[model samples]
Target: MSMRFGSRRQGRLAGAGVLAAATAGAALVAAPTAHAASVHVVTPGQSIQQAVDASRPGDIVQIMPGTYQESVLVNVPRLTIQGAGAQRVILKPPAAATAQGGAPKASTPDTPSTAGAASTPDTPSTADNAADVTPATTANPCFTTGTGICVAGTEGHRLKGVRIQGLTVTGFATYGVAATETDHLVVAGVNASGNKLYGIGEQKSVRAVFVRNHAADNGEAGIFLANTTQEEAGALDLDGARVSGNVLTGNTMGVVLRRVRDMDVLRNSVTGNCAGMFVIGDENTPRGGDLTIRDNEVSANTKYCAPNSHLPFVQGAGIVLTGVENTVVERNRIEGNVGTSQMSGGVVLFKSFVGVPNTGNTVRDNMLSGNAPADLADRDTAGKDNTFTGNSCSISQPAGRC
Candidate 1:
């Protein structure tokens, strides 16, 4: 028994020594040290791809002043490629020059070689270059700014620290800036207009931030967001976005947000658009919860034809709400461009979904006047679980709560 106790004590002492050594080692390794890396300067002929390839996951790519008329794909994350400013680094679309990489690939993506497509000179233009992207002809191309269509697979992606500030993004093969399956994206001081689908289509759970940007004169909705699938249950914090101080104008539907949750919209000006702002939810299956639409001044959002885009008329609704729940729309000044002959609905609460009613929403203190609200294709709910008060409405006409 004595020997056994001695052996047990020895084993405990050995374990304690191992634990002490591990803790000490962890302390030494996990000390609060700054792990800073040097930035790589991308010069002429040195592409962002090359800089990124040379970087080790955490390095910053500082692009100097130049027009990089090349498309790029970033599969890596956690790296910062910051231009000197919005004006410095210009990211253009990938064209035939880069695509028909006929010869053997280069050692580094940034290396300029006269042997292959890198040797080709870039002909730069403006957003009008899409008309020139035919298969047979290669026109002097420009970046897709201010507008375009959203492609099939690239609906949502993250774009951060990228500045098209005064530049335009239009005529995309897809949406100007599609942000789906993306998160924590920051788009500031950029101008996105005249795209095929939407200026921005945020799908899935993208916690995006749009500040000091202009989304105007686009083909379809200015900013459109669709919800994710049902497998992502309890995706509550999936997105908590903020859109502030932005201008949206002259689109099919302006700033249309569908199937999202927990948004903070403040101090933005909406004007001269088809529908100033459209907010709705996913009615078919599971919808989002906990949305806050407040402090936005929505006015002068006029109406027109589908207007240079291929979208349907049913897709246009200013401040339109569908099968949404647990929302608040308050304190917004809604006026002007209420209705014309073609465009209707200043703000619409359309419970047109087949199954459930868009319930549990509260709207208060919104100066909802001078706009034509959507006449329900039909009506069922007698304002249950939804409170509408403190809103200045016209009790006579069918517009603005009349």
Candidate 2:
């Protein structure tokens, strides 16, 4: 799919105020002063982790145009990790580790029992079988944690205002970039590919922005966002988090949003995946909803994915919404997604696995074609007050919906 959609122009304008404020905050931290933050430059054969560890808060770690083999952890708030460019700066696992594991490839999803034993199916697991030789320790958590870049903060002390941009991270066992308990985090202009699990993942975060990135050929979702990774909980109010202008392809699913609220999924190009997008909720205290999904191109997602413990086999699913309420899906172009799975369609509204029905959701004004079974499928007979209107499509499951 081409990433040159004009939707990005409108999407940028929609979030201009918030993005500008964030840029201003970052500038103040980067300004020269008595205790001025320094810029640490790392070149080929140098250690990115060492530079990160040696830097103070608000410092910029600038990586030159070269390949570096190491896992980096950024825990300092208001820090910026800038690379020369995604095409120029490359980050991968160490040569020894690569030799042992024989390079990462897109593989079938592992079963829950053999996968990350402590993690839920909807989240990235900690089991890094590919990098099992490097065990995780207090000092090098990113090594065995199976993450190329990790930005972590404790629940009691959320990391704030960290920016990671202009890099290509690949060949990890798990996520290309993982962040937890972070606020105002920005990940932009990165390419995340060939990871065993999710390309980019974030949990327990608020006001996060993922923009202008490319994610492809990952084992699981291109981008995974959730309330929590390890435990079941109520939905988190994302406080205006945004996923905009990204290109996602060749993963099991393009983007998976689980138990999150108040976010925007806008202007993304999603294609050639098993499923385009999944908006998932369950029987939690506060149900997930109140989000906007708009202006994206979702097409040709026909790759078949086998069923895991939490979900049925998924294929040809343009946008699947389960157990969500008050969500708006509008102005998207969905086409050429064909499959036999129950969830397959241009836009599907199915009941949650826990039998929770969708309520008060709206699907309108979308352009859809060539979707098998139906362009719009409302399989949740028990769902309440869900409306489908102004959609331009050929067919729908219960008839007269198009």
Candidate 3:
């Protein structure tokens, strides 16, 4: 492995954790109140949907060990869906909606699974590649395409306190676990893999805690946080989001934070993807920042989405900051991110938007090595007030900056 390091003389930057906590606390003030207590037990071959339909706010739906082939949407407030264990309980899409049930759909000509210009001669062609295709915007892709578990709340009814734990969600056309316009949600110890889009995705949600989860081998991002429009973002708390102790790999991006704020992404293992954590914002409404990315192992992000995909055609990076501000990257192990483009590196800061350059960001005290092009890259002239201090690296792409 070719290792390169870049930095000026180092000093300790304090209160990173404290700032993260304070930011998270400020965002939680808008969270809804608690719900009434109720518990419902569901076994295999029984209708989990029926149990969900009968449930009220603050109800706990405990599921036993079995393969439940149904797409469940949780709209009830404060609903807790707990399985026996991630390995014991499996939630798959229904047979009719599954990609494997009928005639194999042909891969898109531009898809990575197909014989594209970028595809190697030895690339194995398979029907499983069809699972990675993007779904339409007019419908709920989970039902139309397929999804394992979804916590959906409309703009009028913003669901609160929905908790999902100990479940393995796989073989879905859309997301394995998805949520929108919800609050106070906890997704723990879940294995979300082999899904079409993201392994886990949340849009316009608040106070979410994703802990001890494994999100891998998805088509898009492993864990995605998106706020596309202001109306959708308005329903979110934007306070504290806790993403920790998770293994994210084999996806377009490990964790994608777009137009999200006040998040703490810590102690996670992110690797073998196109890019690790991406903190992005733009000139549009509800731009995101205020993140603390620390204490994680981020490496070997060497995959990219197809050119025809809706996602940006970004290559490997341990972490990327674009059009974002007031963010911190500290105390992490970052290395080995050689992408298709020369911009690939351990960490990259760029101005993704025209007027809104990435500014007021700090890259401090990170252990970076073995990254191609260089360990650190400052790729935009618009990026201002950015500081790289105390990072233990040998060189940067631009010579004198280090």
The TM-score, computed over Cα atoms with residue i paired to residue i, of candidate 2 is 0.87
- If ranked by TM-score, best first, what sequence of candidates would result? 2, 3, 1
What C-alpha lDDT, on a 0 to 100 scale, does residue 207 get in candidate 3? 84
Q: Which residues of candidate 2, in runs, are more than 4 Å off? A: 1-26, 29-34, 103-144
In candidate 1 the C-alpha lDDT for residue 248 amounts to 73
Candidate 1, residues 1-402, lDDT tens digits: the string is: 011113433343334334433443354355432454557888757776666657543455666766554433333343444444333344444444225431111111100011111122211223434332333213211112211211112334443222112233443433556543455555554455655446665555456666655666665566665553212222234357877776677766667665567777776777777666655444334565467778787776665553322222432334555556778878877665456333344455555333345588877787766554342111324334866668775531233343
> Which 10 consecutive residues of model 3 have the lowest summed lDDT?
4-13
Q: Which ten residues in a row have the lowest lDDT in candidate 1?
A: 106-115
Q: Pick the candidate with the highest TM-score.
A: 2
- What is the C-alpha lDDT profile of model 3 across 159-190, one tens digit per residue? 88777877788877667888877777778767
The model with the greater TM-score, 2 or 3, is: 2
Q: What is the C-alpha RMSD of each candidate to the true structure, in Å?
A: 18.7, 4.7, 9.6
How many clashes in candidate 1?
29
